[model samples]
Target: MFNIDKNKVKHANLFAAGLALGTVGLKVLTSKDAKKVYANVVAAGIRAKDSIMQTAEKVQASSGSILADAQEINEKRRQDEALFEEEESDEK
Candidate 1:
């Protein structure tokens, strides 16, 4: 007696149908309008990234200036303390 599995044949047919559908889907996805939309979306993303980078640069510059001012203030305080010590010692 010869025997064949019907279930395996059914699975193979379904797999082939899925592959065909997948090829058609790829063609639809790569159409002209789809490519333009993709390009615009990417350009917008780049612009957003550039804007964020500019803001970050500005913040970094401001922080650096603030740190410089703080250091200057600290130096002035040290100088004032030294002057006070000298004045006390002169009086004594």
Candidate 2:
């Protein structure tokens, strides 16, 4: 009679269990209910992306307006400073 190794038998059992689990997992993941869940997740992601894009557009528009106003204010300040300098030079 040949002697069997306990460690080899234990490893073989574990390997068989892992293979069975993998096959079942693959089937469950490819089932109809899983497909529906995936579709819903993708649809939700699309809606979220649309909402974020709209908010970003609004923020971009607001920033552009703010930048224009700031530039106008700086231009006015520069003109006023030039006028004051001209008046002081005339008085001298």
Query: Best-fitting candidate, measured by TM-score?
Result: 2
**Model 2 regions lying over 4 Å from their true place:** none
Residues 1-92 of candidate 2 have per-residue lDDT tens digits of 97999999999999999999999999999999999999999999999999999999999999999999999999999999999999999999
* Clash count, one per candidate: 0, 0
Regions of candidate 1 where Cα sits further than 4 Å from its true position? 1-4, 87-92
Native-vs-model 1 lDDT? 0.97
lDDT of each: 0.97, 1.00
For model 1, the run of ten residues with the poorest summed lDDT: 1-10
Model 2 residue 54 distance off true place after TM-score fit, in angstroms:
0.4
Residue-wise lDDT of candidate 1 within 1-92, one digit each (tens)?
85879999899999999999999899888999889999999999999999999999999999999999999999999999999999999999
In the order shown, the candidates' Cα RMSDs to the true structure are 2.4, 1.3
lDDT at 43, model 2: 100
Cα lDDT of model 2 overall?
1.00
TM-score of each: 0.76, 0.89
**Top candidate by lDDT:** 2
